[model samples]
Target: MEKAAEFYTLEKGILALKDQIDALAETDDLDKKDRIAALRSEIEKEWARIVPQLTTVNIVQIARHPKRPYTLDYIAFLFQDFMEMHGDRRFADDPAIVAGLAFYKGRTVAVIGHQKGRTTRARIDRNFGQANPEGYRKALRVMLEAEKFGFPVITLIDTPGAYPGIGAEERGQAEAIAFNLKTISILKTPIINVVIGEGGSGGGLGIGFGDQTLMLEHSFYSVISPEGCAAILWKDQNAFEQAAENLGIRAATLLGFGIVDKIIPEPPGGAHIDPEQTFKNVDKHLYQALKKFEGKPVDELLDERYKKIRKLGVFEER
Candidate 1:
């Protein structure tokens, strides 16, 4: 995990100012008020200049920040009565993937996501959030059940990639992910997918097929990681910073490609800076997105989904 000081070098001075602000908040000094106001103005000016000009690599750093809210965090903040389900019926469960039924705004919904842990022990247990074939299968199982119960499906995508170990291949990893894509496309219930962090390769997409796809401001979705792309194309992993720019992995870039429907704004510095506000922003968008399908018939919903999928990557032949 990259430290904030290391990854956000450009913001080091700003961060120092924030530390002073933190100190000020703890004191009952009337003398500090004017100084705090001036410090805040300086910080605001720096932010206004830097936030919009963040480099692609800066975005990659923010998306992978250790302090950023993960899928389970969002579940706790944005939903209620979450009853977690475990295991893929055909095999053992994978801790990297989480699926369950939850209540959102008084409506029952099925929530599934890639879960990377905060602590070392938990991260190892979750395999660093890299799902195996069984994880995807378990997600599909819960999704299928959600369809039966007429519940909307919400997927939070954040993965480096699917597990590529020999054991995973032996268990039909490719087949499992492909199966999810097919079934999710045709699922009769409303599905909304949010790319909350590193959406890398098929690991992200296996549970990412949704009628309405959203991405967080600093998050990215790509066919491969920048480091992987650099290694394959340039034979040097050091070229990842350049690779990130070439890959066009930003939320705004993907939105222009018609790959994602909405870009949910994060806190000014990043989601990790103010997670509660980010949760509120995400919750607002989720409710609005689900409401769009409230009265649509199953056939109409499926038809529209088909058309949306078909239109993706449609290009003019010159």
Candidate 2:
């Protein structure tokens, strides 16, 4: 359903228009043909306006746009000499979460992200991009390695959420995520995180603590998904439209709330339309964000990070 070929939003409307066209073509009446043409025009106009202002649920599907740039896609485009590291040492390698040594924009950086495979087989193989506890642990280990080596860390978050299955819970999913947050808090290397798609719940929190947290426009982050919130708050799953509005999950909304540092604008028609352009924009911002702290002292950077985190709920009583 999150696949790329389904990128166009007006598919259903367009399909109806096509069906009308076919029906009119087979009919004996010229009046039916004229009606079909008028109907097509109306559908086109309505879709033109709605496509750009797509809803959060619609965006959720688009964020997973099969054609969207995945971690591996961007990695190959922006980095070279990627030697993929494997496993937590305590467990087997996890494909859902990919952490490895990479040369990014001519600098050696340890990179990690949720890796959703491209095809049906790939999705099943990747567990639909949901990382298990072991995966998070492996990612934390790689980040530490990057810090120890003084190499910057680049974390890309794009998941519905951490795996919520019984197996993951048995292995301590919450503790594994907490370990990442704790590790990232004091890690010496400059860390940069980008919410390339759906940065859902704790799965994102684990990798999201960074000097700069960026989000892609049309992407979303949420404590609970719209459907989940609706099911709990309204007692009806169909109230997702209202629930999405209340969630404050959009990238622009998150930036307004200071939850994200910046919003990376995607190409018109969505990121799936021109991933190359999206990648370029991301590359530029990342360069600026990385350079901002490149020459700064580690202790000062550490202080700045702590201050950034602490500023979240500061208030003044008048």
- Whose TM-score is greatest here? 1
**Candidate 1 CA-lDDT value:** 0.91
Q: For residues 118-183, what per-residue lDDT tens digits would candidate 2 score against the true structure?
A: 999999999888899988999998998998889998888888889889989999999999989888
The TM-score of predicted model 1 comes to: 0.93
- How big is the positional error of residue 61 in model 1, measured in Å on the Cα after superposition? 0.6
lDDT of each: 0.91, 0.82
Residue-level lDDT tens digits of model 1 in 193-311: 99999998899999997789999999999899998999999999889888999999999998997899999998657788668889999999989999998667999999989988888
The TM-score values for the models, in the order shown, are 0.93, 0.84
lDDT of 1 at 116: 96
Q: Candidate 2 — which residues are off by over 4 angstroms? A: 1-7, 11-52, 314-318
| Candidate 1 ranges beyond 4 A from true positions | 1-6, 20-43
Best candidate (score: lDDT): 1
Q: How does residue 167 of candidate 1 score in lDDT?
A: 86
